[model samples]
Target: MDWGLVGILLLMGAGGGFAAGLLGIGGGMVLVPFITMIFTAKGFPPQVVVHMAIATSLATIMFTSLSSVRAHHKHGAVQWRIVALLAPGIVVGSWIGPWIGKQMNTSALSLLFAAFVTFSALQMILNKKPAPGRELPGTPGMFAAGGVIGVVAGLVGAGGGFISVPFMTWCNVRIHQAVATSAALGFPIALSGTLSNIYFGWSEPGLPQYSLGFIYTPALAVIVAASVTMAPLGARTAHKMDVVSLKRAFAVVLFGLAAYMFYHAFA
Candidate 1:
């Protein structure tokens, strides 16, 4: 292992996990872009770099979600009912996401990732609220929403919070509950996306050593270790801090990340 890369991954995990806690994003929104930069700078091939970055970033969510949810649950912030209603669709949609990714080339995947990140940034910056009397839909509608969330999240390596939080809040869920619930939802997203990406990329060539399909194991291990340590702290901070300014600052950072991904798409 390159010790230097490991140190950087550690820092990435610390930042990603905190973001996951603060933003309920499962760290993927932060991890994907940074991992791509790391891999790209090392001269990795585009196919392996983009796919592995997404896969490894997603794999870390399994641990971060658990840590984050524990903190949220301690505060009675998780909405379990909604999690149950959304899960079946999420699993099915997540299973298909990596297959769709497999069919796309490096450029297309990069562009898609960029678009998703840009949308997320804009959504954060806008911070719109839903109309009064707007409520969560019926079971069928929840499933449909879950399907869309799962597919997009799996494709982009997010925890689905970018979409799910606003959605839950729009339906009149409390912000704290929405964040907690989104953290809980991360487990399912991570499990299905990680498995599917592994399966889809299993036979691909040119992957580096210490890799499991698309996941770079060293990065995954270090990131998970570091992220898990920070997620709970982030969760605690969420309940105690007023983060409006922080959110805007983070949104600005996301725009920069999106720009990098866009440049990468055509590079």
Candidate 2:
């Protein structure tokens, strides 16, 4: 067995799970760049490296979502009604996203993911407060927003929190509540991304051994084991810290991740 690889994956999962709980990001944002690095370093097929990283990251989020959301739900922060209304649209959107993604080459996908991460990080840095009179949108508007979020999440293999949390806050939802609700949203996003990646990648050649469609099962098992343990701890910390400050710090990290991916794409 490759102990070094196992160690790296374990560490990745732990960090990703913590981020999922703390930022309601479902851990994909944290996992994607590093997983890309791992796949590239291992000499995986150039055409499939980005796709595999994204697909695997989304798969990990499936576990982290449940673990983190459970913790958030206990704090009474999740908005179930909002989750219900948004989910249907999210599901439909997610189905479309992978098809769109498959049309792009690895370089294009990586560059796009870099762009997505950078945009999200900038929003945190700006910290734009909403107008007091703003409120959650009507059902139609909410559904439309959910579709957009889902599509983007599936495209980049993220949890949709980057867009969802900010959108909720812009609609005057409290930050804590928005975070929790975003965590809840991770489920559908992860589910769709996972399934779609699998479907899209199923027939691709040169997949590494132990792969399930686009997912590397060995890494998936190890990452899920570690992430599930750390998620609740991160959730507890989220409640105690100055969340805005934490978010700003995380944004800086996102910037670095984005830069690296940009380089990977262009260079």
Candidate 3:
């Protein structure tokens, strides 16, 4: 194990986790690109590096999501009903996501990730509101929406907060409630997505040492350690300040990450 690399991963985890807690995301959006760069620097196979990064990102989220949710729940902000309604469809969609991802080549997946990140960033920057008096969908509609969120989140290793928060807020949920609920939703998204990635990549060739399927266990361990510890802090911070400005700042960061991914995709 390279201690230096481990240090870098720890730093990445801290940053990602803080962002996750603050934003109600699972931190996968921050972890994926940085982990990819790390793996690439270590000369992991280009074809599999992105997959490994995403898988590990999801794995880390399993812990970070739990930590964030615990903090949010303490504040009584989580909407358990919404989580229950969305989980089933999320599981199904997450299960299918890795299979579809595995079918694509590295460049394609990178481009897709870039596009997704760019869209999320733009949405944040625009801060658009739904038409007046818009409400959340019915149970069946929510299920379908969950499925879409799951598929896209699984493919990109995100916790689905970007979609879920907006959806909830549009339906008249308070911003705090929406953010907290999104944190709750991250659990199923990360769990199902991580399992799918592991199953999909179990027999793939050219994996790095210390990897289980597409997840690099060493990095996962280091990242989880840092991220879990920092997530609560982020949740606390989110409760204390104006998150709207933070969201815009986060959008700028996402745009930079999108550009990074785009560069890597076509390089």
Q: Estimated TM-score per prediction?
A: 0.97, 0.95, 0.96
Q: Give the residue spans of candidate 3 off by over 4 A.
A: none
What residue runs in model 2 are displaced by over 4 Å at the alpha carbon? Answer: none
TM value for model 3: 0.96
In terms of lDDT, model 1 sits at: 0.88
Better of 1 and 2 by TM-score: 1
| Candidate 1 lDDT by residue in tens digits, 88-205 | 8888777778778888888788899989888888877887655435788999999999998889888889899988988898889988899899999999988999999989888898
Per-residue lDDT over 150-248 for candidate 2, one digit per residue giving the tens place of the 0 to 100 score: 899888888998889878887878889999999889999889878888888899898999998888888889999999999889888988888787778
- lDDT, candidate 3, 13-67, per-residue tens: 9998998888887888788899889888889999988888988998888899899
Alpha carbon lDDT of each predicted model: 0.88, 0.88, 0.88
The Cα error of candidate 3 at residue 221, in Å, is 0.5
How many steric clashes between backbone atoms does each model show?
A: 0, 0, 0
